[model samples]
Target chain A: MLKELDPLLHSQLRLGVMSILMSVESAEFTFLKEKTNSTAGNLSVQLDKLSEAGYITIEKSFNGKKPLTTCRINRKGMKAFEDYVNALKDYIKK
Target chain B: MESENKNLSPEQSLDLIASMIRQTQGNVSSGSFYFLLWGWVITLCNFGMYILAKFYSPSNAAFIWTLTIPAWIITMIYASRQDKTRSITTHLDKISMWLWIALGITILPSWIFGSVIDWRVNALVLMPVGMATFVSGIIIRFKPLLFGGITFWIAGTLCFIVSPLDQYLIGGVAMIFGYLLPGYMLRSKK
Candidate 1:
């Protein structure tokens, strides 16, 4: 029996965001947009969804008068990402 | 890049994760600036102190080290600029930063108390530096820095056996091998 793929992480942008977050301590909103090649609006929406699901934390602050957004993967998100990768491996191995 | 909302197959998802990891790996910025800057500065200070003590006067020669005040100020400015420009901070980067900061804090007490007690503090300073370099190398998995750290330890040991003034020469050589050489290597790799 195969594990179910995480619906929240199955999409390209969300998966990309999580992958990037997993590799770093944290990343700025601009960085995610650039790395994922998603429009600002689309990236914001996906980030909000991930934040709502407790997969990531979004911090909004100011960097020298400019509004800054930073995203970090929480422990729950890390576990989910790991489980997702294992499930994906199970599917690919067959 | 694929469309944001599109569903990905398992293989595609794995590939995406692998690629993103590679991208982050390559994003490690150059650390050569700090290494080269401090390497040259300390090397020059050591040699300058040696020459001054040999010829003119040993009384005020240590004052040459005061130049480090300006060097550190410039380093701070350079570091702030780099931080502003950088897009991501990896776990390794954070660890390296804190390790060096801890090293700096250790140096303060060594300097103040060593001078008061009239103790030779070269070994005292160099040991922490070696530990910092070694740990940073382990964090980044960089062989040159790992070797550089060992070089510092060896030089520190030699300082105990050599005459007081010769420690300056040994330290200068150590900076060349331990910091400048590895610094250039890191720059080229970057």
Candidate 2:
């Protein structure tokens, strides 16, 4: 039986963001922006979507005078990512 | 890499994940400070003690070790500051941190019981130091540190064959190769 890929994770930017978050404890908004090579507006929108889905958490604070945003993948996110990869493998095996 | 927001095929998705993970691995190389600091301190102290013992006075040789107190303080301060400021922390970084902390604890008994162990303390310290270095190298995926760790173990073994005074010389040289050399290389990589 073929498994369905999570629609939320199928897009390029969100997948890239999630991939980077998976590798680290948490990442700054700038770090994600640089790694994904995404514009601020686009990255912010995708991050909000992930946050709304409860796959990840976003922390907004200040690093001195500048606004700092950090993102972390939660347990749900981890499970989802793992499931996504498994589904990916299933597709590849075909 | 712009946010095209386009959906990817399974193959493209897999490729993206692999490349992103590879990019994060480079962050592990930022640990050069501790290695370089300890390398210079230990090496200089070893050489200083050797010179003092051989030339001026064996009694004065032990005084050189006091420098480690300041080294300990600086390491603590640096680690605290780094923790507050670092934007990212990988599992590898956490594992490497705990490994060194455990190794440091293992080495403490040797220092406290230096009189009981005598000058063999150098060899004892080297073993755990080697373990930490070797493991750290593997965690960071750096080859020089892996070799450096082996160098420490070899130096430690050689210390047993030499006179107490000569052990200092070996320890000093070992730090140069095991710690300083790889440390500089890591810094350059960063």
Candidate 3:
């Protein structure tokens, strides 16, 4: 069955972010920024969309009082990605 | 009721993911400084003492090890604390970590099963580490690690060929070439 797909996650930038995060245990915002080649404002907006859809989670804290932002992939997101890939595979298989 | 804590920002979603990953790993950023510093010291000293002892009698080697066990035991009590605070903080770090650990596991047993500690055991350890790295490199395709793993595998085989006699200098050289140097390369890397 095709699971409910997230439109936010469906976008290129957000999709790329999730793809990378899916492979990694977690990553920092700056790392993701460099990776996706997305500007700060745009990446921030895209991440907000994914976060809204329950696909990924964001964290903020201080490392010796300097703020650090970290992101991780969640289980629901993993399942979704696995299903998405499987669904995508169906298209590819034809 | 949809109460005060409303929608999360993109950052918050990222944070949730981070927390979940940490939960799976069960690593807490609660390491003690003294212990980490001591681990650095212990490993370094062990490397040094073991090398120097090869020239002398087995008894002499025993003397060189006088403090290592105590230090290792003591430091391990607080080792987990140090593990968490570092980054390479992503899951990629975890892969690197297990690669390093598997190297230790394979080498440590052979090192312990010592009549003379064949250097070839290092070669055996290299097989998995190399394959993992090479495979991962192709998939994620990082270059240096792939190269490094292959290099270590080749060098490890050489170590075994000339072993025991080669134990002292070659072991030192392989680790320097195989691990320490590569580790530095990875650390200073972008």
Candidate 1 segments whose C-alpha is farther than 4 A from its true place = A1-3, A60-68, A89-94, B1-4, B116-119, B134-147, B188-190
Note the Cα lDDT for every prediction shown.
Answer: 0.86, 0.88, 0.55
Error of 3 at A36 (Å): 4.5
lDDT of 3 by residue, B67-114 (tens): 656765665654454443444254545664465456557656654664
By TM-score, the candidates rank as 1, 2, 3
User: What DockQ does each listed candidate score?
Assistant: 0.60, 0.65, 0.09
Q: What value does DockQ give for candidate 2?
A: 0.65
Clashes of 2: 0
Residue-level lDDT tens digits of model 1 in B14-37:
999988777678555558889999
B1-190: candidate 2 lDDT, tens digit per residue? 6645566889999999998887777676358999999999999999999999999999767889889899999999999777657777787778888998898899888877876866468899897899899988888889999999999999999988999999999999999999999999999987
Q: For candidate 3 chain B, which ten residues in a row score worst on lDDT?
A: B26-35
Error of 1 at B177 (Å): 2.5
Candidate 1 chain B: minimum summed lDDT over ten consecutive residues — where? B111-120
Question: Residues A1-94, candidate 3, lDDT per residue (tens digit)?
Answer: 5443345554556666777778677777776777666787887877787788788999887766667678888888888867765555454445
Native contacts retained, all candidates in order:
0.69, 0.68, 0.11
Candidate 3, residue A26: lDDT: 75
| Least accurate 10 contiguous residues by lDDT in model 2 chain A | A61-70
